[model samples]
Target: MNSLLKCRYCGWVGGKSDFEWDHMDPKIKTESFLLDFLQGKLELICSGCNRQKSDKTSQDYTFWRWLFPRQANFGPIRAHTFMDTLLQRIHREIR
Candidate 1:
């Protein structure tokens, strides 16, 4: 088990287990509503992010919506193009 894991969103360092596995990947390129199952994860995130997502809070919800724009199908969806777009955005930021 990893004693120290850094969050990709906020970069908070802690035990890997402390982070909750986040469903849905932000980096999917295709429309989630079109697919039946997700191609990404259940990544370990901090409680703060988890709570925000669970509650669908304004800030967190918007953040997630921007990161992963889905049609609210209530299930997994194939995510490839979404990831590509997300990666492009990230790359643009670094450049």
Candidate 2:
């Protein structure tokens, strides 16, 4: 049986086929490409959200309609933690 998975960005829950892996930070330009290789840099989100996010980082509000409402489902604490982890990963890549 195919177990259901939830989108880390949106609250969409469905089978694995409905989702795709998204980079937590998509704007990183690295010579060795170490950023994508790091842990906590990937998230499983729905294909629709993935396409909407495009190459923009989560910090970018270009897709506010898709991002903000869905993020609210995470509540304040989980949302803060999510953003904190994303920022930490970006900082790690920078240093």
Candidate 3:
């Protein structure tokens, strides 16, 4: 499956040799690794991007996108959705 996949986070297009499978929600932080894997929360990313993203949750990436605006593939529409989700999560926590 060489070059058949693209990095979802960094948009890197390359062969399988350069790609790495990263768990978007991070298996280490989640309750069950098997559950996370079975839930389809994994993504293919380039080695460099995998290192840079490094177990950061989607919320973390959302914040990083706000600060850097050039780190990954968080576009405007996606950013709006992400921020909305983030706000909802925060509101729930505060309540």
Candidate 4:
């Protein structure tokens, strides 16, 4: 059996087909930056979460939901960890 993958944002577990690529930061549009981002900065999230996060950086999306209690769906701790790990990886890659 194939190993299941979890969506970093929503924690949904499923086969690879159930996930899609998302950029950790969506504002950098340079070709070289995109290539670098594709190497490791891409996030794997479920379609629903991806659609909800469209055009927004992970930080913005998380913060917006956090600022408004009614729109929050996932746990804050999990989202914080995800952001922390992602930022660490990005920093390491840049150094």
- Could you say which candidate leads in TM-score? 4
Pairs with steric clashes in candidate 4: none
lDDT of each: 0.54, 0.66, 0.66, 0.72
> Candidate 4 deviates by what RMSD?
17.0
Candidate that scores best on lDDT: 4
For candidate 1, the TM-score is 0.39
Q: Candidate 2 has which clashing residue pairs, if any?
A: none
3 against 4, candidate with superior TM-score: 4
Task: Score residue 74 of candidate 1 by CA lDDT.
Answer: 24
lDDT of 1 at 81: 59
- Which ten contiguous residues of candidate 1 have the minimum total lDDT? 70-79
Residue range with the least summed lDDT across 10 consecutive positions in model 2: 70-79
Q: How many backbone overlaps does candidate 2 show?
A: 0
lDDT comparing candidate 2 with the true structure: 0.66
Please state the error at residue 48 of candidate 4 in Å.
Answer: 0.7
Model 4 bad stretches (over 4 Å): 32-34, 37-39, 68-95
TM-score of each: 0.39, 0.54, 0.53, 0.60
For model 1, the stretches where C-alpha displacement exceeds 4 angstroms are: 25-38, 55-95
Residue 67: error of model 4 in Å? 3.3
RMSD of each: 16.7, 16.6, 14.5, 17.0
Q: Quote the lDDT for 53 in model 3.
A: 71
Candidate 2 stretches with Cα past 4 Å from truth are: 29-38, 61-63, 66-95
Worst-scoring 10-residue span by lDDT in model 3: 71-80
lDDT of 1 by residue, 1-94 (tens): 4478765555567775446655544444345543514444345666555655664433555576568755211222224656889999999999
